[model samples]
Target: MRVTVNGESLELSESTTLLDYLIRRNLNPAVLVVEYNGKILHRDHWSQIQIGDGDTLEILSFVGGG
Candidate 1:
């Protein structure tokens, strides 16, 4: 399936979960928020949400500064 991440095109094989994708890309869910298809998805649901073709995701990471 094909999806867009932060405006970049990405191709993923069958049965890929949101959580799996994040981990694969070395993204830490603990410090980031995901906007799935224009809606903010709860972190608890990341593991269960299956990514579909043409899905758009905005991965925003939180940075700590003094």
Candidate 2:
């Protein structure tokens, strides 16, 4: 399966849950906001949402600064 993340194309072996993907990439879901196919996804649904072929995801991580 293929998906695009932050405008970059990637190949995935199979459909995966959003949380799984984030964890695999060493991302902390608590500090990030995700947009799926143009819609903002709530953090509560990350574990339940499935990412499949051709899906587009825009992940924005929150950074703390002075």
Candidate 3:
């Protein structure tokens, strides 16, 4: 299956969840906000939300600096 991560195209196995995909791409979920198909996914819900074909994902990581 093919999916896009942060605007990059990637091929992954079927039934891949958002949380699994983030791990595979070395993305840290703790500090990042994940949006799937225009809807924001709660950190706790990533494990339950599966990424299907043609889904557009936007991952934004928070930076704390003052």
Every model's TM-score? 0.93, 0.97, 0.81
Measured over all alpha carbons after superposition, the RMSD of each candidate to the real structure, in angstroms, is 0.9, 0.5, 1.5
Ranking by TM-score: 2, 1, 3
lDDT values, one for every candidate = 0.94, 0.96, 0.86
Candidate 1: segments with Cα more than 4 A from true spot: none
| lDDT string, candidate 1, 1-66, tens digits | 899999999888886899998999999999999999999999999999999999999999999999
Question: Total backbone clashes of model 2?
Answer: 0
Candidate 2, residues 2-52, lDDT tens digits: the string is 999999999999889999999999999889999999999999999999998
Candidate 2 — which pairs collide?
none
The better candidate by TM-score, 2 or 3, is 2
Best by TM-score: 2
Residue-wise C-alpha lDDT for candidate 3, range 1-66, written one tens digit per residue: 787878999777787888988898798889999889989978899999988988889999999999
Model 3: ten consecutive residues of lowest lDDT: 10-19
Instruction: Give the Cα error of residue 36 in candidate 3, in Å.
Output: 0.4
